[model samples]
Target: MNLMYLTFQEDAPLYLGVKNKIEGQISAFEKLGYQVTCSMWQDNRFCFFGADSFQRPLDPAKRLMKQMTSIANEYIGGHPFDVLYLRLDRVSSDMIQICKTARANHVKTIAVEIPNYPYLADYMRNVKYAKTLGTKVKTAAKVAVTAADDRLSGRKLKQYVDAVVLYGNKADSFFGVKAMNGDNGINIDRIEPIPHCADTSKDIAILGVAGTLWWQGYDRILQGMSTYKKSRSDGPALKFVLVGGDKTEMPEFRALVEKLGLSEDVTFCGFKKGKELSDIYKTVDVGASSLGCYRRGLTRCSSLKAREYCAAALPFLYAYDDAKLKEDTPFALRLPNDESPVNMDRVVEFVQHCRKDPSIAKEEREFAEKNYDWKTIMKQVLEFAGASMK
Candidate 1:
């Protein structure tokens, strides 16, 4: 089988998660016995990779909309694949035409993955933070158009799109199409577990690694650290080692850290990768997964970081309804799903509880092997996606 995977994600260095995810998923598809091709838009050009990797620049003189239509007509109309997969960003006219062309070219199965469902609220939140009057006005206008386009496109997409690959699916169907329920699945081979020998007698460290900042909910962690500092002067000293989160919001977070007098307790390790990230992981007692997903209008999420934490055989804290992990799960400490600050006392206790169990790392590694691996998750997705289409 041959698969054409499509996404609008960029090849930017800052947010490597999306790039890494696409690469992992493509590998999983190959493992499932499909030859994969990745189609992406980056650096003002349309690029293709995997089976036959290439890049073609778009004409700068023409609007992107016009260029997208031409590209769809020229490429999708000429080439056909057994399956077409999309990491849908938005439901724009260009995307509609792309789907229509792919279907016309006799693509056997077409599935679009909506990573975040009901994402309009996230855009509205962005509108709130717009810096100037003119910027806010432009942003508000764009949001209005996008909302209308999405509503219209959702219905139109059903004609070409056979199924939706959804994460944290709230309904059996989305926009009048059946949903293949799914979550963020990791490539376990790529994520090696941290080989750490826990030392509970010394100070504790917590790690948060993410490219995007606002939604990760590090503020709650900072607040917890602040309260931890003030209330328990004798409490075991805590350190938060953060990687990435260099977006526009970093300055505000820095100010908050200073305002709360948590300079000594927190260390900002901005934008780390490869060995640098691995070295940081070895020092931390526990990992912090998405703590403020509620900010994105999500009560539950299959967070990628949560899976990464498990793959690393690391105990962690999270504040959302996970696809896996129960409230009683020993390796994980679940927090309330809201805007409240995390209680540092609870965090400290969770660390101690994890240290007491020698089998925690083994248990976590087992969990990742069984539940979070890409091959297992992708097989389930393929069962519903490709087979169901036939």
Candidate 2:
């Protein structure tokens, strides 16, 4: 089967999620003995035009449709495809017509990739809930606006596609279709988890945090570490490493660490990528995954980082409350609730155990290789796509 993959919005060179996912799937399908061709929009003038500037409402939609239609008409006029896979946020009515035309010609399957869903009003409600739970609502309205925009964009794209390749089970249920999951399949086969490189020399117990600092449970980790340090002064010095830093938001976190007298202990490593990141992971004894419960319904969605953590064989502490995940994932130390802080004693005890029993780390790594590896996950994706394995 000839598969044509389309990604119009995420046209970046390095950090484009949609492009990377599609590329991963394409490579997997090829290995499974299927023909795949990716048709992506590369805007040479995007940098010149400014990313946000070009993302303005109707004007860009019209321009994009015209460009997409012209290309689709010229390239696909005579050629026929079995599957037309689209990773579009929002498409013009004209673009829908083009897809319909393709479906009429030879495209038997049309799958749209749904990466995320945002419920703006629900998020606002969540902000209020967070406030009730004694958290600040600094950017509630802004978060709501962004969430609403994504929801509307996703709905608009769904109207034109035949089926959706959902990134999560929650999205699959939301779309009310037989959705294929892609989270497991869309990474480079041998790509190690966060803090990529292994550094065995560091004696200090390294705890790596990769995601947003202000996110749920992150402060918990910091608080727990502070408590642990205060309780046990004689133990080995534990270094708390923060990766993937948004410099603008670092001040509040730094202040919190200072207030707790953890300045000497906590080190913000800024952003490290490729082998450097892998090495950081190796250096760290333990990696902290998300510890927040799904405040929004979106938590039902599996985290890409969680999968990466599992892949890297890093024993993680997740705050996921889904029953599906609880069923049989041995790679994570799942927390019970989002708001309830993790027990500092338990964390300290676990760390001590890990230090004493190196076999615990070995077991976690083995679990990752068996279950969370991209090769294992993508095999399921290809089978769902009807690509035959050789």
Candidate 3:
């Protein structure tokens, strides 16, 4: 079988999360004896690759149908793809046309990896950080209009796609259930999690980010750390080493850290990659995960950071109450839904306890190896794909 994988950030070198996911899927599909081609957006153009992939840009400000038609005429000239798989986080009018055009070309199956919430939810959340009224108003209006367009697009895309693949085990009710619903014989696949391994270790907790964008709630970490520091003068010092995200929210995070008086407690390591990232990971005692955002709380998340922490044999501190992880899961410690000072104090205590018991980190790594290995995740994905075909 031949498959075409498409996502927005296909060609970018950054956006580690998107890159890891796409690469994992591609590697897995190849192992399953399928010819997989990836089509991604990069450099204001669409890049299609399979040993000899090429890129072409779409004319901007064109209608959705026209855009799809113009691209499809070129893309589908060689042969029909067996499946058109989209790994996008959200739906858009252009996405609807992309699917429509793929179906029109007799692509046997269409699939999308659905996230916990619409992309608009994330956009609106980020808009809260905008300093200027004009910027906030413009971004908020665009998000609202996009959200409406996505709703319409989703309703249409749901009918066109043969399968909808979700990440976590649980469904997010706030995201609206129309796309996730399997009422129309649409194959729904909830693939297993994938693990990210690192050779490094550290004694301090690390909240790592790449590029600029504050989706992971770094501000709350400082607030929590300040409370932990003030209350636990006698306890061991809890140091938070932040890696990356300087470009995304360097100014805001820097200002917030100063306002909270956490300069002594937290350290910013700028951006680290390759050997530097691995070296730092070795010193890490615990890995920090998201505290969710203001809008959705911590409902259903597929935290790549948490998985990496576990893969590196580090205990993870997560704010979300995950239904998939049983109470006995040794890999993670759950924090309160709120990132309040009181709750963060408990998180600090948990870290201290983990520090004393070094075995917790080893056990966490074991759990990650057993459950989150990419090979395991891909097996499930391929099995679901096979079942869907039947």
Which candidate number has the best TM-score?
A: 1
TM-score of candidate 2 against the unseen true structure: 0.69
lDDT of 1: 0.81
lDDT of 3: 0.61
Model 1 lDDT per residue over 275-297, tens place: 88777888898899988888888
Candidate 2 regions exceeding 4 Å error are 8-23, 39-80, 88-98, 117-162, 168-174, 180-182, 185-217, 234-236, 321-331, 382-390
Better of 1 and 3 by lDDT: 1
Output the lDDT of residue 303, model 3.
70
The candidate with the higher lDDT, 1 or 2, is 1
lDDT value for candidate 2? 0.56
Question: Against the correct fold, how does model 3 do in TM-score?
Answer: 0.80
TM-score of every prediction relative to native: 0.94, 0.69, 0.80
lDDT of each: 0.81, 0.56, 0.61
**Per-residue C-alpha lDDT of model 2 across residues 2-81, encoded as one tens digit per residue:** 76665555355333333445566677656655576666555532210211122222235466645655555545445676
* Per-candidate clash tally: 1, 11, 13
Q: Name the weakest run of 10 consecutive residues (lDDT summed) in model 1.
A: 381-390
